[model samples]
Structure formats: structure tokens, C-alpha cells
Target: MTTSWWTFGLQTVNFLILVWLLSHFFWRPVAAVIERRRQMARDLLDQAQADRDAAAQALEEARRRSAGFEEEREKILAEAWREASEARSAALVQAEAEIATLREQSRTAIAQEEEEAARVWTARAGELALTVAARLAARLDGAAVTETFLRWLTDKIAALPADVRSTLGAAGEVEIVSAAPLEPGLQRRVGAEIGAALGASLSFSYRIEPDLIAGLELRTPHLSVRNSWRADLTQILAEINHDERI
Candidate 1:
């Protein structure tokens, strides 16, 4: 076998040219594409980590806001309860004061009514007594009654002190009031009896008053002697009224 040196050398040169072409075109471009893809993946992973941290911070802030809102609600409720209690106490005090005032007014009104009733009953009793005395006096003998009253007057004057009798006689006139007119003889007798008791001469005046109710009244300027049924009945009624009031 005859070996050709030139042919071997030409083949070696062609292989070297093909190697340069593949390195400059297909190999360099494929390596560049792979490197760019790796860089993009790293950027995406960093962005995902930042997003997770921001989400955790937002959740913590939301929890703090919720706690503050709950505390504010509790404080407002306590204040409202305190205000309501104070208002209730004030209303009760006012109501009690009003009740006390009303009770006092009622007591005063009751006392006044009792006093008025007592006065009315006393007036009625006095009128009834007066009527009964007048009727009894009408049934009696006027002359006999007048004589008895004159005798009583004479006795009363006799019982008086000497100084009192002298004072009564110094009035210059002795008035004799009766329910009916006296006869001239009876009048003269009464005058003599009174003069004997007083130990002095006195001017006499006889007068008729139907209201005397079968009795006599001897009057002086500063002294009077009443011996009459009407006057006795009035005194009794006054005593009874005073006792009832007590």
C-alpha cells in the first residue's frame, strides 16, 4: 500500500475548519441561552421571599388593631352603667320627698275639719237648751216667779260685804228687770226689801224683758246679780263645750 501524505494533510485541515465553525455559531449561542434562564429563575425566587415577609407584617398589624377596639368597647359599657345607676338614685330621692310633703298636708287638713265639726255641734246644743228653757218658763205663774226672784235678790244683797253694798247703792239708780210687768204693791215691797238690805235710800227703775225667762236681774253701774234660768243654762252649756274641747 502506497500512503499519500498530502491527502492526510488536507483532511486534517478540513477537520480544523469545521471545529472553528461549530464553536463560533451553535456552541456559544446554546451556552448563552442556558445562562440567561438560570438568572431569571434566581430573580423570581428572591421576589417570592419578599412577598412572604410583607404578608406576615400585615397580619401582625391587624391583630393589634382588633385588641384596641375590644378594650374601647368595654370601657364605654362600664361608663354607661355608672351613669344609669346615679340617675335611678336621684329619682328615688325626689319621689320620697314628694310623698312626705303630701302626708303633712293631709294631716293639717284633717285637724281643721275636726275643729269645724266641734264648733258646729256646740252651736246646735246651745240653741236646743235655749228653746227648752223658754218653754218651761211660759208654763209658770209670772207673779209668783217674780216674787221668788225678788226674795232671792234681797238675800244675795244681804250676804254681800258692807263696802260692796255701799258701792252698789252709790250708783244712784237700781234697775230691776223682769220677764213681766210687776204690780205696784209688789214693786214697792221689792224696793223696801232692797233698801233694808243695802241700808240706804236708792232710786228704783222697773223694766220688763221677756228674755229673762221667769227671773230677775238687779243691776248697778259696776255690779250685777243675775238669778235667771236663761243665764244658768248658758253657763252650763259653756262648761260642757269647754270640757269636750279638752
Candidate 2:
């Protein structure tokens, strides 16, 4: 190598100039651009974080509102169910009361109907008994029955009170009523017996009544004495009717 101090010194000076130029222009500009880009990236990250926080807060608020709505709906449904149950119970109670009332009414009606039926049957039995007695008594109308009744009449007249006998004797005439027509001889005997019993000689008139049913009756304007099967049957029927009423 040929040593050249002049060439070496010149080269060294040019290198120094180049180094200063690069430091002042290129390096400074590139460092400023990088710093600016880093600042912008930090600002963008801060904005994104803020937006995410706000979105999370909104989601929590929506969840709280949904829970409140669900609770309200449940409360309304429970209230409606309770009201329906109360209504059903009231209806059942009313229906039961009505059924009991109807049953009581029916029982009362049945008892009344039974009482009426018994009364009607009792009346029918009384009528049947009276009819039987009347039919049987109708067969006993005969001379023997008449003669017996005449003797009883004489006895009855003989036992009369003093005032009754006086009243009979003072009457215009005695009416002799019988179930059958008497013979003239019997009539004379009956008049004699009656007049003897009354201790008076009395005129007499005769009349026949078949309804006496085998007995005799003494009648005046104000007094009547009945001794007949028909009268006995009638009295018996009246007593039976009185007992039933009691």
C-alpha cells in the first residue's frame, strides 16, 4: 500500500459530514413519527375500554328489568287462582243449602198426605159398620119384635115422672106410632094398658112408621122418647166420629 496522507484525510472529513447529516434529518424524523403513532394507539385502546364498560352496565340494567317483569306476572297469576277457588266454594255451599231445603219440604208434604189418607180410611170404616148394622136390623121386623116393643113401651110409660104423666093426660089425644099396623084388638089392649098406666082414660090415634127398625117411639109436641135399633146405631156412629176427632 502506498501511504497517501492527503487522500486519507479527505475521506475522513467526508465521512464525518455524512454522519452529521443522517443524525440531524433522517434519525430525528423517523423517531418523531414512531412516537406519534404510539400515542395514537394508546388513545384508541382507552376509547375501546370505555365503550366495553358502558355496554356491560346496559346489559346488567336489562337483566334487572326482566326479573321485575317476571315477578309481577307471577303475582297476577296467583291472585287470579285464589279468586277462582273462592268462587267455587261459595257455589257449592249455596247448592247444598238449596238441596236440604227441598228435602225438608218433601218430608213435610209426605207426612200430611199420610194423615189425610188415614182420616179418609177411618171414615170409610165407620160408614161400613153402620151399613152392616142397618142391614142386619132390617131382618128383625116381626110380630114378636113388635109385641116385645109394646111391653117395653108400657113399662116405660108406667115409670114416667108424675109431671110427665100429667102433661100426657092433659094433651088432646095420644098418638100411637108403630113400625107396623096393629090389629084392632091389640090397639084396644095397648090403649087400655097405656090409659091404666097413666091413670087416665085417654082417646088414641094410630100411625105407622117403618123407619123405627123394630122398636117404638113416644112423641109429643115438645118431648120424644126413642128406643129403636136405628137410633142405637146412629148414636154409636156419632160416638165413633167424636173419638176420631179427638
Candidate 3:
């Protein structure tokens, strides 16, 4: 083959020019674009990593808040249960106190009723005793009983205090009350006996009082001497009533 040095030099020169042009324009611009794209991709990757860390922190905070809420709910439930128990205990104590009060009142009422019944029976008994005494005294009224009562009246007048006896004697007239009318003979005898006992002569007036039952009573304007079964029965009834009260 015949060698061509000029052609070879010319071809070599063209290839060097082409290489410089590509390095200055196409290669430089393409390499710069690729480098910029790579930098953008790295920036995106860094941003994604930061976002993941922030999201994880937020999730942890949410979990902590949830746990706090659960603890608060338990506390509220326990406090409510404690209050309810206290209320129940207080109600039970009140109910028992009321029941005890009612029972005491009932007992007091029953005791009062029993006492009232006993008092009523005692009063009735006292009345019956007085009635029986009065009837028996009435049956015993007679001439012998009259004579006996006249002796008793004379003795009663004799036994009086000196001042009382003097006052009775000083009175111009003395009244004699009896259960029945006296015979004229008996009246004279009775008046003589009374005058002898007083040591002074006095006027005598007679009166009938059936309520005396079986004895005599002497009466003046300001004085009364009761020596009779009726008076005795009245004293007994009063004593019975007083005893019942005690």
C-alpha cells in the first residue's frame, strides 16, 4: 500500500479538533446536568429521613398521652366507688337509729297504757268499798246504836281541848244532828246529859241528816264536829286514792 502522510496528518488533525469541541460544549454540559440531578436526588433522600424521624417522635407522644388518659379513667372510677360506699354506710346507720327510736316509743306507750288501766281499776275498787260501807252502816241504825252514839258524842265533847270546850260552852246555842228524829223523852235525857258534861246550861236544837248513816254530828255556825260512819268512810276513800297515786 502506498503511504499518504498528508492525508494521515489531516485526519489526525480533524480527530483532535472534534475531541476539543465535544469536551468544550456537549461533554461539559451533559456532565454538569448529570451532577445536578444526582445532588437533587440526595437532597430528597435527606428530607425523607428527617420526616420519618419527626413522625416517629409524634407517634411516641400520642402513645404517652393515651397511657395518661387510661390512668385518669381508672382514678375517676375508684373515687366514684369510694363515695358510693360511704353513702351506703351512712344510710344504714340512720335507718338503725330510727328503728331504735321507734321501738323505745312503742315501749313507753305500752307502759303508759298499763299504768292507766291499773289506776282505773283501783278507783273503781275504792268506790265500791265506800258503797258497801255506807250500806252496812245503814243496816245497823237502831235505838241501841243511837244510845251508843250519844255516849260517844258526850265523850268526844269531854275530851276536847280546854279552850275549845270553853268556846263551845260560851256559844248560846248548840245544834245536834242525827240520822233520824229523836223521841221527846230521849231528847230531854240527851240535853240533860250534854249540859252536865259542858258544866254550863245551853240551848239544844235538833236536826235530821240521813247522810250521817249511823251516828251524831254537832254543828254550830262556825264549827262542825263529825263523829259518824259516813265521815270515816270518806277518810278511808281519800287514803285509798292517795295510796294509788303513790
Which one wins on TM-score?
A: 1
Global lDDT of model 1: 0.80
Q: Please, what are the lDDT tens digits per residue for candidate 2 over residues 1-246?
A: 346786798889989988889978998889988988888887788777877788787888788878888888888888888888887888788878887888788787877677667667665765566567557666765667777877887788778898998888777587888767888998898788878877888898888877665676666676655666556666776686678667
Off by over 4 Å in 2: 1-141
Give candidates' CA RMSD values in order.
Answer: 9.2, 12.3, 8.6
Locate the minimum summed-lDDT window of 10 residues in model 2.
125-134
**TM-score for model 1?**
0.58
How do the residues 1-246 of candidate 3 rate in per-residue lDDT, one tens digit apiece? Answer: 236887898889999999999999999999999999988888888888888888888888888888888988898888888888888888888878888888888888877777677767666775576577668766774788889988988898899887887788888798988878899998888888877777779899999888777777777787777777677667776787678668
How high is the CA lDDT of each candidate model?
0.80, 0.75, 0.81
User: Rank order by lDDT, top first?
Assistant: 3, 1, 2
lDDT of 1 by residue, 96-177 (tens): 8877777777777777677667767777767677677788777887787777888888888888998999898787899988
Taking all chains together, the TM-score of candidate 3 against the true structure is 0.50
Q: Model 3 — which ten-residue stretch has the worst lDDT? A: 121-130
Name the better of 1 and 3 by lDDT.
3
Query: Please, what's the RMSD in Å of model 2?
Result: 12.3
In Å, residue 10's CA in model 2 sits off its true spot by 84
lDDT of 2 at 32: 85
Give me the runs in candidate 1 sitting further than 4 Å from their true place.
1-109
